[model samples]
Target: MSDDRRLKVLSAIVTDYVRTREPVGSRALVERYRLGVSPATIRNDMATLEDEGYIHQPHTSAGRVPTEKGYRRFVDEVARIKPLSAPERAAINALLSGAVDLEQVVARTVRALAQLTGQLAVVEYPSLRRTTLRHLELVALGPTRLLMVIITDTGRVEQRTVGLSGRGPDGLVDPAVLERLRLRLNTALVGRRAVEVVPVLAALAEQAPADERAVLAAVTDELIAALRPDAEERIVVAGTANLARSLDFTAIGTLLDAVEEQVVLLRLFTSEDAAHRDDADDTGTTVRIGSEIHEDALAEASVVSAAYGPGDAVAHLGVIGPTRMDYPATMAAVRAVARYLSRFLTGTEGSTPG
Candidate 1:
């Protein structure tokens, strides 16, 4: 069989099934799409495709639906991401510009992606690994307790209240001493990335007065844990209701469980394939269908994701839907959103929040 002609028939089946949400027939394929071949030829091609495990018939009387193998071929060999329309670019610019914080930026991106692609949208929080400390504040909550607030350049704020001064709550901290230590920490740790802060924290702890070393050590330990490479990253997801609308979702309960777990979704975005060496369009976007996801809960779903950053992927944005999704359109929206977010983060397009 000619690979090109068979692939053309498979592509038409995928496109029609995605649009109509029904098994597609060879007659419909010939009438709607310009296969330029006779129905008998299309039928022969489809039979060959099915024999090769590319398409399947759920019922003996019904037409065929693209199987996972079929969708994989279409995605890998046939689909080209549609270019964003001028209006789409304009809308993205208007909606994403003027965000004031990282949370808002992520939320807007997720919701926009959900709306654009009509799928469940997930956007990973800007990883602290790539961000610098903009400021660090220490506030006394009690004589032996303090609240530590970490502010990153990306506008993420993490706060922790710790009373681990080692001497226990009975041994009160001097107000003046706490104030001095706060100033010293901010002076040394501010303007440094997570990787750069580790050594600086160790030095600060090492040089501290004997009485203060324990407190500084505790603080540094917490910060180090927060910056650990294995830290569980957070992701924001919207359009869960989109899944409810689909009768075709195979394991709605389990898929919802996976969404709540988020670890599975995070791995999906931060997988080995997501990181790219350069900003080429082909290498940056990932399309995972069915068992390709390797998650049983997502066995009947398709995910389109793209990493967005200055160059290497500091974070990822993705759309999740049933296998019968508009691959080209979803890929286009995911890639476009990723590009706009990359520009925003690098201070090239949207104003960076302070």
Candidate 2:
């Protein structure tokens, strides 16, 4: 049989199996799809597909199901991600428009993706190591205390308090010195990655005047600690009930456990080789089906992920469901949500929180 005709038959089998959750028989393929071929030819194609390990029969005298390799090929060769309708786009905008902060935006994104795809959604928080500084502020709260706020380009804000010494007779930080430090820190730190900001701050403190040196050093210490990367990254998950309905009862427990463990999920996203690199689109949307995902617990599940920030990936968001999912629809939803998230983080979408 010709490769093109064989692939066409395999595509039909995958589509039918995904939609009805049943193995596809040669007769059913002939009846349902316009293959322009006889049932005998279709049966021959099915036999060839089985020989190639693309489809397999689960029981005696039953139709065939697509294997992982078949699904991978179907996604790469036949699947075209469906575009969102006008109404669907409008609904996403309405749902995500009200988010006022990074946390709220992430929460809304996960919910929207889950609802759109009918699958469990996961959104990773922006990584401090990957995000650049947007702004920094210093405020005096009392005679011996100051507040340092660090904001990133991704709109994540972190704050820390610094205790001061060498106050004036009135027991207040000198306004002139505070203003100078703020200007210098902003000039040096803004647009730099969080991991690179600390050393710059320390250098700035060393060059400060004797009277302001202590305050600058204290603030530097606190800011460095605040910007340091956490041992484990954070992720927000929603729509776990969708998993219960779609996956086998025996596999749901392990899948949920893996989702609950942030470390495991983070590995799922960053498992460098696991991601399907489609150079066709610049969005970096990846699809991992069945065994492509290295985690033993998620062996039967599919993960559709996309990075959502400026430049390279600052964080990832995606959905998890059974391997027999609607790849076109799910990939489209994941891509759309990630694009909106990138816009929101870059101040191109809605108003960001104060």
Candidate 3:
């Protein structure tokens, strides 16, 4: 069969099946798509496509639907990614316009993606490991209590309160003393990894007088806990209501719980290191179709994800939706949101969540 004719038939079947969520028969193809071919010729092409594993039928009497291979080809060759419509652009603008900070902006962006695509939306927080320290604040809350506040280059702020058994001289260790400690810590840790701060913990402890040694130890422990990676990758998800409203309700019902959704999302974003080639530090957007992720539950799901940060810092942002989702529109929305979020996290804009 001619390649041109095969493409036309493939396009017809994909378009029809996507619209009706039903199989495409030769008669339906000829009637609707009108490829200027007799039923017999189209049947022959269908047979070839089925033999090539690009299309499949539920049974002998059923029509054909595009297989995963067929869908991949369609995504690569046929689908045209386009920007949101004027009304949609306005809605997105309105939704994101009032975000007071990066956290709110990211939450709003996730909601917008889900609303626009009618699928589950996920947006990952910027990874803390890739961010440098913007500020380190030490507050002496009480005789035996201390508070360590860590501000990252991405404008993420984390504070941990530490309690010590031994009390220090209260009036002698006021805001001025705390600021002196903060300046020393920041000088040593400003551009380094949070983990790298471990070596200096001992030094900071020695800097304090004997009476305040215990208090210093407590603050160091709190700072370490706040900087850990497990505390960093926490994701925010929204618009799960769209999943409940899907026409394929039964197929997704068992997986609609928050725990299950989080698991599915983590698996989708964690790429095998082998798959990443040049510039391992670069942030990016990726889309995966059915069966590509090697999971049965997600076989019918399409994932649109992105990594956001400084060019050297890698982090993820994006959404997951049904395979029949508006691919072009969803892709455009995901890409745009991811780009904007990267800017927000990097402090290019004067916005950070409250």
Ranking by TM-score: 1, 2, 3
lDDT of 1 by residue, 175-243 (tens): 666777888998998878888998898788779987677778777877887788887778999999998
Report the Cα lDDT for candidate 2: 0.83
Give one digit per residue, the lDDT tens place, for model 3 in 282-350.
Answer: 224456777776666776777766566666545676676667666667777776666666666655533
lDDT of each: 0.81, 0.83, 0.70
Q: Determine the C-alpha RMSD for candidate 2 after optimal superposition of all C-alphas.
A: 3.7
| Candidate number of the best lDDT | 2
Better of 2 and 3 by lDDT: 2
How displaced is residue 20 in candidate 2, in Å? Answer: 0.8
What's the C-alpha lDDT at position 270 in model 1? 62
* Number of clashes found in candidate 3: 3
Tell how far residue 338 is off in model 1, in angstroms. Answer: 1.5
Q: Per-prediction RMSD in angstroms?
A: 3.5, 3.7, 4.2
List candidate 1 stretches off by more than 4 Å: 164-180, 261-263, 266-283, 351-354
Models 1 onward score TM values of 0.88, 0.87, 0.82
Candidate 2 residues 296-343, lDDT tens each?
Answer: 888888888888887767888999899889999898889989888988
Worst 10 residues of 1 by lDDT: 272-281
lDDT of 1 at 247: 76
